[model samples]
Target: MPSMRTRPSRIVLIALLVVAALVLVAVVAVSAPILLHRSAGGSGQEIPASAVPETTARGADGRVRTLSAHDGDGPADLGAVAPGETLRIDGSGFDAGIGIYVAVCAIPASSEEKPGPCLGGIPEGAESGTVDESRLTSAWVTNDWAWRSFATHQYSDASEGSFSVTLTMPEPASTGLDCRETRCAIATRADHTAGSDRVQDMLLPAVYE
Candidate 1:
């Protein structure tokens, strides 16, 4: 019952509305993949001042760098570490600060691989800190993970997103045991002053120091 002029106008309006709805659906379909990617990979997490990622991670520092523990005699080879040698940690994603660390533990002499069996991950907890005390009652541990920090360079120096730090390897006496002449597992950590100082506490177990 509408006029001819208004009937044509309504038809045009309906066609425009249909086109708009189609455009909106196309936009959402195109963007759904991007949204899913961001959800799965995260939007690049911020690297806290001193806190390292929970797992072996590239973090924000850049590509994942190999963290090797050696006394300079051709890499640790994941075997018996030499005594009285300075440990050099070269890698990426290490935050800059004076509290860089190298934590060592004697792996089970049995045929277990590094970081397996009696040897667990260092900086061992939800946050970056010493291994869980309640879990390390029997494992051979160090008196202090942070012994000789020799980091003069800041992580910011790595404009290319790489960083390195070196610490003097713990001695036999440092582990509160005669582990100097044994094969060990090494884990790197940092002070992360931006985090909690309580995590920096390096003490012995079952025996107060």
Candidate 2:
């Protein structure tokens, strides 16, 4: 009987198998990051379908304002929201195509000489300005407040329809925050469909106010 020996063909086959395995491992490694990025999209946190993100602030006058809004409608009357309730808004604006930006903030005291984009607190050591409704001069004090604290519900399509947004505010276990006089500002960065980049803003004063 002839003694069995390793064949050249068998050796080459083994090398090919090793190379194939390495290729598969490399493919998996390369796709992992992309897979993670897609999965981690959208602020990397899970919120309820109707949940609206909000920011809180206290005015010098002792009133509290909680700000939030959706894609199209002006900011909802957050003061009217019950602890477990959802606020639905209906409206139209220039940003009907892209969506609306909503911000809820306490308008600083008139004495503070606060400015536009008063939706959030002014940043520390930042440029403080003023929003003159008379002259139409608006100033957004950076570093003092938080704007866009939550993304607007971006489901508004063309044809201009109504959109709903929900925010889960903390329970007012003894009139925690005087949502009275709280104002909601909804701004839309309009799409230049017609001519101008007309941004529209609507302020919904608190129900009590």
Number of clashing residue pairs in every model?
1, 7
All candidates' lDDT scores?
Answer: 0.35, 0.32
Candidate 2 has which clashing residue pairs, if any?
A: 52-166, 67-104, 121-144, 121-145, 122-144, 123-143, 123-144
As a whole number from 0 to 100, the lDDT of residue 68 in candidate 2 is: 39
lDDT of 1 at 103: 48
Tens-digit lDDT track of model 2 for 114-175: 21233323222223332221211111211101222222233343333334343333232223
Global Cα RMSD, each model: 17.7, 18.3
Best by lDDT: 1
* Candidate 2 Cα lDDT to native: 0.32
- Where does candidate 2 have its weakest 10-residue lDDT segment? 39-48
| Pairs that collide, model 1 | 50-192
